[model samples]
Target: MIGLVLAAGAGRRLRPYTDTLPKALVPVDGDTTVLDLTLGNFAEVGLTEVAIVVGYRKEAVYARKEALEAKYGLKITLVDNDKAEEWNNAYSLWCARDVLKRGVILANGDTVHPVSVEKTLLAARGKGQKIILALDTVKNLADEEMKVITQDGKGVQRITKLMDPATATGEYIGVTLIEPEAAEELADALKTTFERDPDLYYEDGYQELVNRGFTVDVEPIGEVTWVEIDNHEDLAKGREIACQY
Candidate 1:
């Protein structure tokens, strides 16, 4: 399976640090940047082939990729999305059309997780499901987190990025595994939505698939730590989590 790391965001929320550098290149601990930690996680998971989608300061991300490959003999492909400023993560995925196929694992570059993510991807492979989303039942979910509404504990009823915390049932932690058929379904869903409305967000595409009776299993990732770094607070938390690893 191929791994796709979405690192193309402008990261406007990350201010000064992102003003001159990509969010993925921002240093977290001493020598390692947030992107290094992310790629390290993939390496631990035995994922040798990786495709990174870069946009803002694309050169920096690509430079890091080159350094990592030279240092560790790692294999990472860079997919540049020139239109990243015009769209969202969905567009990044679209840029990776050649790589995102059956048994593909797409991860966010801003998050650092333990090595078990590879196991999560493998577990979701034979379930015969279209989409498998990693869910973590944690107490720190905010309104901005992706929330999942599941039915019968196996199928996702809905996925909402904006919702009242009190009404949120669970969190959809950004990691996802999709079968080949599901990728086609997702592509079709995205195309249909874009044809109808150009400004539709990517989650709407997944929601469309869910509405079509496609099975979206919420695979629980218990005790396996993952950190999402969007701001200073997240950076602190990510550092703390990395210390444990």
Candidate 2:
């Protein structure tokens, strides 16, 4: 499987940093960027081939592509998302549909997490599940978190930010393992998701999968230090936790 990163979003809240670079390019640990950590984690997990979906100041990534490849010792491919500034990540993810056929360990570009999370997902592979999400059961869920609901034995029943936090089982930590067998259906679902509402998140696409009878399982990454950088506050927290990793 290859490493897939969805880095196409325009983080308007992160003004100065995101003005010239995409959110993933924002440095968290000295000179090491979020994308750098992601690539390093993928390489550590034996996924030497990586694909990144780029937009919203994608030139920054292009400028560093060769350096990133050499530093990570991995082959990198870029997938373009033209609507990155106008639409949400459901379309950004769908833009990488061709790469998904190879199966992928997908990491959200703006998240900072340790290699153990990748290791955990890899360890849980081949368990008869097509789509596996990394859930943080320890974190206290809020309305801002992308929450999950699971049935007793049926895996994930719903994933949405709009859901009541009190009813959630855990929070999806912006990491997922998508098996090759699930690519076509997932791509189709993502297409439907974005076509229906350009503002919907890729998590909505996962909801679409569940609505179509797909079993989206979850692997709890027990008490991990991680952050999804959205605004300045998140970036500050990301920098603090990134060094620990």
Candidate 3:
């Protein structure tokens, strides 16, 4: 199966650090950045092909991918989302539309993770379910993080951005294993949502799916080590997590 890494975000939160580089290339643990860690983990999970959506500092992302290929012989496909500046992550995700079918493990390039997380998510394949990693919020989450609201146990009733401080139980890590058919349906819903409202974010896609009566299987990871490097402080914490991984 193909692995898709959503790395095309402009990373406005990362600011000056991302002024010259993409957040995925930010240094973590000595040499391994989120980009490297993500690709390496996918390789360990038995994914032979990877498609990465790149935007900011796209050349640097390409160079890193080339270096990884030389060192580990990974086969990676790079797709550029030219609208990265104008669109959100859903745009980056759509860049890999052809590869996202039939349950590919989709990850955000800004998250640091242990290789086992990759294996575990990939194992969700063939379960005939739409699986999204349900991450326990270690601390207070911000407005941009996707929060999974559980309903009826074992089901995700809604996945939304922090609408209010009272709305979230935990965060939704970008790591997800979705069946191809489910993804296609979600993509169509996302397209409709976007056509109606151009400013819709990625979480809106999940909300739309949930509203349409789709069951989202939650794969809970009780702090197995993952970090979303949304800011400089987050980057520091992500570095520590990278070392442990």
Candidate 4:
């Protein structure tokens, strides 16, 4: 199985730093970047090959590719997403559809969390869960969170950003385990999503899976701190949470 990372977004909210580099390259723990942490986690879980979708200052990733490969001891393949700046991540992820058909551990490049999240998903693979999302079932729901409504807290019923916070069971932590079986179907769904709207998020792909008959399950990382770097405040939270990792 290869590791897949979506690091194409420009992250305009984080100007200056994002002016020259993607958010994944932003340093959170001293000089360690979100890309570093993600690759390190993949290494911990024994993922030796990784595919990264890059855009919006793709040169920075190309410049560091050799160093990143040497440090992580993994073969790196950079996938280009020309629409990364023009569209949202549904297209960014669709750009990696060819890679996703293989089993993969996918992590958003701008999220910071511990390696334990990787361990959790790897362990849960035994349950025959084809598509498993790392969820924070204990965190307080917010409007900005990618919320989920599950059936019996086991099967995902719906996942969306527009859901009312009061009805959400938890937040998807931007990490996922996609088995080879689910990846093909997921790629199709992502295509349908992007064709429907260019601004849709990949979370919308999860909704597409649910709309069909596929079951998308969850692995709750209870009380394990994580932060999605969206803005300056999230970056602060990411820095604080990253230190604990």
Candidate 5:
């Protein structure tokens, strides 16, 4: 399996830092960047080949690609997202569908988390599940969180930010395991999702798959520490989480 990262967004909420670099390159623990941690986690989980979807300020990623590869001992492939500044991540993820068919453990580049989360997803991949989402059932979720509602104790029924937090079973952490068999379906779903609305989040793509017959299962990472870096508050939380790791 390959490691995939969607690092395409401009993250305009983060001003000065994002002005020169992509959010993935933002530092949490001094010299260690969000991409650094993500690559390290993926390498720890035995996925040494990683594909990063890059868009706004992609030149920064290109400049540091070699250095990052040498540091993490990971073979990095860059997937360009032309609509990154204009469109959302559904299209960004869809850009990688061609190469990720072997299987993939995808993580959002702006998220800071321990390697244990990657380990959890790798362990759950053994269940022969087609698509598995790493869910944080223990987190205190709000409306901004990408929430998920499951069908009974099994598959994901819905995943979106618009859903009522009260009805959500848990938050879908920015990590997902897509087996080889499900990659094409996911790509198709993403196409449909982007076609419906260019501004849809990638979670909507997962919802499209759920709308079809695909059973996207959830693997709960109970009480684990992680933070998705979006705004200044989230970046602070990410630093805190990274310090623990």
Candidate 6:
């Protein structure tokens, strides 16, 4: 399976740093970027081919693509999402539908996490589940987290940020294993999700999959240090824990 990264968002909340570079390129450990860590993790798990969806200062990615490839010892594919600055990530992910057909271990470019999270999802493969999300059962949920709810033996019942945090089973950590069998349906679901609302998140597409009776399972990444960087505070937190990883 090839590694897929959603690195298309503008991350407007992050100002001057995002002015010239994408959020994924923001340095967390000296010169190492979030994307650097992601590529490193993918390489650690033996996924040497990667596709990155890029937009909003995509030139920066283009400029560093060769260097990153050489550094990670991997082949890189760039998936362009022209609407990344205007729309949310559902469309950004949909832009990589063709790459998804190869089966993918998807990581959000803005998240900083260790290879253990990737290993957790990879270990859960071959369990008859088409989609397996990295769920953090240990983190305390809040309104901003993409919360999940699963039924006993029924896989995921719901995943949304609007849900009551008190009822959620865990938070999806933005890493997912999408088997080849689920790719086409997920692409369709993502299409429907974006067409319905241009601002919907890709997590909503996962919800669409569950709404259509698809079995979406979760693998708990027990007590891992991870951060999804959205703003300055999150970036600070990411920098603090990134060195540990």
3-84, model 6: which lDDT tens digit per residue? Answer: 9999988888988899998999999999999999999999999998999999989999999999999999999999999998
TM-score of 6: 0.99
Per-residue CA lDDT of model 5 for 133-239, tens digit only, reads 99999988887899999986569998999988989999998999888999889999999999999999889999899888788999999889888889999999988
TM-score of each model, in listed order? 0.90, 0.99, 0.89, 0.97, 0.98, 0.99
Each candidate: what lDDT?
0.74, 0.94, 0.75, 0.92, 0.90, 0.94
lDDT of 2 by residue, 105-134 (tens): 999999999999999998998779999999
Candidate 5 lDDT score at position 147:
96
Predictions: Cα RMSD each: 2.1, 0.6, 2.3, 1.1, 1.0, 0.6
What is the RMSD of candidate 6? 0.6
Candidate 4: give the clashing pairs: none
Candidate 2: minimum summed lDDT over ten consecutive residues — where? Answer: 149-158
How does residue 124 of candidate 6 score in lDDT? 91
**Clash list (residue pairs), candidate 1:** 102-180
Candidate 5 global TM-score? 0.98
For model 2 the local lDDT of residue 162 reads: 88
lDDT (10s digit) by residue, model 1, range 1-245: 76777888877777888897777777777777767776776677777778888998898876666788765456888999887777766667767767767356778778777768657766666657767777886646777788877888558877877777666667776778776777777877766665666556556677878888777777778777777788888878888877666
Candidate 5 differs from the real structure by a C-alpha RMSD in angstroms, to one decimal, of: 1.0
